[model samples]
Target chain A: MTQVSTTISKEKCFEQLLLGKTVKRVPGQYLSGSEGWLEAVRAEALENARALNFPSDRHDDWRFTDLSPLFQHGFQPVSSFAKLTPGDIEKFLIPGSTRLVFVDGCYDAGLSELGFSGSAGAHGVTVSSLVERIGDVQVETYFARQASFKQDAFAALNTRFFEDGAFVHVTGEAAAPIHILHVATRREAPSAIYPRCLVVMEPDSRATVVEDYAGLEDGVNFSDAVTEVVLKDDAQLQHVRVQRDEKNAFHIGHCSVAVGRGSVYAATSLAFGARVSRHDLHAVQMGEGAEIRLNGLALITGRQIADTHTRIDHAFPRGKSVQLHKCIADGAAHAIFNGKVIVHPGAAGTDSSQSSRNLLLSGKARIDTQPQLEIFNDDVKCKHGATVGQIDADSLFFLRSRGFSEERARNLLSHAFAAEIIIKIPVPSLVESLSRTILDRMSGVRT
Target chain B: MINKDSRVLLEVRNLRAEVVVDGVRGVEILKGVDLTVRAGEVHAIMGVNGSGKSTFSKVLAGHPEYTVTGGTATFEGRDLLALAAEERARAGLFLAFQYPVEIPGVSNSALLRLAYNTLQNERGLEELDPLEFEDLVLEKIKVVEMDASFLDRSVNEGFSGGEKKRNEILQMAVLEPRLAILDETDSGLDIDALRIVANGVNSLLTADNAVVMVTHYQRLLNYIVPDYVHVMDGGRIVRTGGKELALELEARGYDWVRAAA
Candidate 1:
C-alpha cells in the first residue's frame, strides 16, 4: 500500500483542490485481494479529481446547487466499525431472498444471512466478499474494464480505495435473483463509507439484486460507493436501488452496467433522501439483440439537491433502450437530470428514446433537464426530450372549479405526476410504498 | 318587478370585446351584442365558423385572451365581468370548451372534486372529503353513463372525440352551474355519441336553471330542444325565433336565412 502525504489542512481540502494545488491522494490500502487493479484506479482517481477541481457556484451545471455541505465536513477513510451486529442484519433483510450486508467499508459475514437456510450457496450462485474472490483471473480482467474513471469522480474514488466490496458470480443457467443490501451506518462525524458491489452474470442466466443506501442515525456522514455490472450472452438482470439517508448526509454513487449479446437488463432507481446526493448511471449495449429499460423517479423536498446523469451507448446493431425519469421538486430544492443516448458508427439498427419531465410545486423551486441524442448512423431511430415547468394553472383552476381545496388540488396533481413513473416499477409493494411516501411528502405529512 | 317564473338568470347588455394578441394591440371581435337568458329556457346560438360564437363564450368566461372593452353582464344581479375566469366558474357560470384541454397528470375525478369544492366554498357550503367526494362523483358517473375506469384516468388524455364530449357533460352534471354554456359541444361527435351527449345535457336541465347551446349544425337540437333559437352573423344576433327555426334552417340550409335577412 502506498501512502501520499498532504500539506493542506483537513478543513481546507475543497478549497485547496479548487485552487488546482496537487493535494496528496489517500493511502492505497487494499484488503489483501484488490492488488491487481489498485495502482490503475488510484492514478485515475487523482487525475479525475484534479480535472474536476471541486465545482464552484459559477459552474453553470451546478449553479443552482450550493456545495457547502461537501466542504463543511471533512472526509475520513472508514474500514472497521463496532456498532453493526448480527441483530441489525435481521431488521434490514429484504424479505424472500438472500441478504448481503456491508458495514462501513468492509463486508461483514456475521451480519449477513443467506435465505436458503440449510442449502449451501448453490451451482451458478457465488456470493462472497470481493477480497475473497479477487484471486480469480476473471475478476482481475473485468474490474475496471466496464467502468471508466474519467466520466465520474466518485467511481474513481471508490476504485482507488479498492477495499472489501461484494462480488457475486452467477454462472450458466442460474435462475434466482441475487439480492445485495449495502447498508451504511454512521457513528462519528465526518466519516466516509466506501462500499462497492461487483456483479457478473454468465451466459443464459437471470438474477435480481437490490443496492440499498440507508443511515441509522443523524450525523455528518458521507457515503461514496460504486457498483459494476457485466452481463454475458443471453443473461438477464433486474436491479433496483433505494437511496434514503439522514438529512445531514452526503451520498455520491454510480452504477455501470454492460450488456452482452442477446441479453436484457432492467433497472429502477428511486432516490428520496440525502442533503446533497448524486447518482450517475452508464449503460452500454455492446452486442446485437441486447435490450435495456431504465425507469427512475425522485421525490425531493426541503433544501436537498438530487442529480441523476445517464448515458446509454449503443455500440452494436439491433440494440434498443428506453429511459424515463420524472422528478417532483418542492420547497426550495433543485433537481437536475441529464440523459444522453449515443449510437456509434456501425450501430445501424439501433432504436433508442429518452424523456425527462419535472413538476415544480413552487415558483422558487428549480429543475434543470437536458436530453441529448447523438447518432452517427442515419438508419437508426432515436428521440430525446426534456420539459421543466410548474403545475398547470388552468388545470388547477379547472380542478378547483370542481370543488377541491388549494392543498388537495396540489396534492392530486403532484401525486399523478410521480405516479406515472412509480406505476412502471416492477415491484408492486415497493411501488405502493413509494406512492404513499410521495403523497405524504407532498402533503407535508410525517411518514 | 321580475316575475317568479320569468326571472332572468343571465343578462348581457351591449357586450363588446376585442381580441388581444402578442401584448401589442387588439381587434374588436364582439360589437355590442345583447342577450338575455331566463330560467327554464334553453337558448341556441347558431352562427358561421368565424362569427364569434366561441369568442362570446370565452369572453363571458373571462378568458385572458379577450378583453371586454365595453359591456355589462349581470348574473343573479352580480357584476360578472369583474370576476376572474375561475371566480365566474365558482359563481354558477359554466362554459364547456369547444376543445377541452387535456391535463396530462390530473385525474378526471380529482378535477371534478376541485371544481365542486371551490363552488361550495363560494356558496358558503361545506366541503366534502376524499371518501365522500368519490361517492358523489360515482353517482354522477352513472348519470353520464361513463365507464368507471374513466374516473381514474387522466383528464381528457387519450379520450376519443366522443369520450371527451361526454366527459364535458359529466363535468356539467357534477358542477350543476345555474347557467350552462355549451360551446360547439356537438362538433366532434358521431350520431350515437351525439345522442348520448345530448341526452346527458337534457337530463341535467331543470326549471330553475338555463342552458345556452352553441352549435354550427342542427343535429344536436333534434335531441335537446331549444325554447328560443337566435341566428348570429358578423358578431351579433340577426334574428330570433321559436324551436322550429332549427328545423327550418336544417330544411332550407343557412344560405336561405342569409338571403332572407
Candidate 2:
C-alpha cells in the first residue's frame, strides 16, 4: 500500500486560468482579480466545521435544535449537465420580467433574452453574463474594495467556484426597473448550481431585481447562490429572492446589500422548499439618512429544515432599519431564525428593531429563534425580540364551536397566522396564490 | 302542564347534572328536571343566581365539561344527547352564551360563513361560495342593526359588553334555529341594547320556531313578552303562570316564591 500527495504551485494557477479564458475582451465585471476572496473561503469553511463540532456554551442560540441530521449525509459537487431549450425557458418564465436562464451552472445565451428593447445603446442599464465581464479592470477594482467574506462559508464558496452569473448595472439617472429571473433546473444524480448576481445602482437611480431558484424534477441537488448589491448616493433598490426546490435538494443562499447617503434599500426572501436550506442576508448603511427594510417568510413541512440568519449594520448617524421574519412549521419539520442589529460608534440617532415569530402546529414540530442587538452608541434606539409558541387553543375551540369542523378550524387558524404577513405583499394575485399554496400544505395535517 | 297537541319543539326528561370541583363531585345542579316547550310560543325561566338556570341551558347545548349523569333531550323528535355542541347547533338548537367567547384573528363574517355552511351541510343542501355567502350575510346583518364594519373585525374582540351580547343575538338571527335559548342575554346590556336585542328576537319568531328566555330581571320581558313564565328554584319549576307572573315577581321578589316553596 502507498499514499501520494499532490501539490499545485502559483504557475499552475495562472496556467489553469489561461486555459479557461474564452472571451476576447472581458466586459466590466466583479470578482475577477481578487486573490484574497478564494483564500478567505477556505478559512471560513474550516471555521464552520469547528463551530459545528464544538458549539459555544455561553449562549442559548442553538439550544432547542439538534444539527446532527444536516451533517449525516455528505454532499458532492455537481458534474452532470442538463441542456435547456428556448421553449423550456418560456415555460418557466415569470410573467413580468426578462429571463436569464442558467443550465447546470453555465450561462446559456441562446436560452436567455435580456434588455427591454434589444438595443445596444447605453441607457443607464447593462445586463450580461459574468464570464464576458470578468476581465474588466473597473469590475476587478470594485470587487476588491467591497464586502467582507470571512464570516460566511457559503458566500466564500460561491465567490471561489461560481463560473458565470448575472451582472446588472444602472446609470445615475435611470428610472425604469430591471428584473433578473435566474432559473436553475436540476439534472440526474446529485448536482449543484452556483448563481452569483451583482447589481450596481448609480447615484439617483432606481430599480428592482428578482432572483428565483427552482428545480425541474425530483432529484438530489444543491443550489449555492450569492447576490451582492451596491446602491450609490440617493439611489433606491428593491430586491426579492424566492427559493422553491424539490424535497431532496439543499440550498444555501447569501445576499449582501450596501447603501450610501440618503439611499433606500428593501429586500425580501421567501423559502418554501428544500430538505435543508440556509439563507444569510447582510445589509450595511454606510452614510447618513440611509434606510433599509428587510422582510422574510418561510413555510416548512414534512422533514424539511430551513434556517435564516440576517444582520443589519448601522455605521453612520441617523440611519434606520427594520426587520421582520415569520415562519410556520408543522409535522416533524424544524425552523431556525437568527437576526442581529449592530450600531457602531458615532452611529447615533439610529432607530432599529428586529422581531422573529414562529408558529408551531404540531407537538413534534420545533423552532429556535435568536434575535440579538449590539450597540456601542448610547443615543441609538434598538430593540429585538423572539417568540415561539403553538397556535392558541382558545382560538381553535372558538372556531370549532362556530360550526367549523375540526379540520376547517385548524385550516382557518393556520391561514390566518400566515396571512398576517402574506397580505403585506403589494401584488394581490401573488399574495392570494401564495396563501392558497400555504393552505394546501397545511391541509394534510388537518385531514 | 305542557299542551300535548301544541307541537312540542324540545322535550327534556329526568335531566340530572352535577358540578365537579377539585376531583370531587359537588351537589347536583339539575336534579331530575322536566320541561317542555311548544313551537310558536315564548317561555321565560326566572330564577336566582344559584338556581341552575344557566346550567340547564349549557347542558342542553352539550358543553363537554358538564357531566350528564342521567338525562335525555329530544329536539324535533331526534336524540339531542347524542349530538356534540356543534352538531346540536346544526340541528337547529341555538344557545346564546352567557359569556360570549372571543375568537381572535377570525372575522365575524368568516365565522358566520362557517356556521351557515355547517347548517346547510347538515340539511343535505348545497353550500354557497364566498361571493354568494357575502350577499346572503349582508341581507341578514340588518336584522340586528349591526354596522357592516363589524363583519371585517375579529369575532367579539375588543367588543363592549353590550356589543358582545348583541353579537350573540345577531348570530341567532342568522342561524335561524328552531329552538332559540338566550342564556342571560340581558346580563350586561343597557336599556337601548336590550331593546334592540329584544326587537331582533321578536323579528325571528314564527309558528315553526320556539324561544326560551332565561333571565333574572323583568326588564327584558317588558320588551319581548313571553307566553308562559316559570319560576325555577332549587333546580325545579316551583311555579308556572301566564305573562303576569313576571310582573308579580318584579313587584314581589323571589322571597315570596321561596316562602311558598
Candidate 1 to truth, TM:
0.79
Q: Tens digit of lDDT per residue, candidate 1, span A1-447?
A: 122223344337643322322122223424642364756666777677666555567865556556676766656665345457666655445555566777666666666665442142476567777766777665776776766666555566666664577777777443444556666665543566767888888898877777777766666667777889999889988888878777777888788899999999988887788998888789998799898889887788888889887889999999999998988888888888878888999888898988898888877778888888989998898887888877776666555444455566667777777777776666565566667767777773211
lDDT of 2 by residue, B10-63 (tens): 999989888766557777998877788998889999999999888888888776
> Measured by TM-score, how close is model 2 to the native structure?
0.76
* Candidate 1 lDDT over residue span B112-197, tens digit each: 77667768878889989878998889898876689989998888999998899899999999899999999999998999989889
Cα deviation at A214, candidate 1, in Å, is: 4.4
RMSD, candidate 1, Å: 6.2
Instruction: State in Å the error of residue A395, model 1.
Output: 3.0
| TM-score per candidate | 0.79, 0.76
Shift of residue A401 alpha carbon in model 1, Å: 3.6
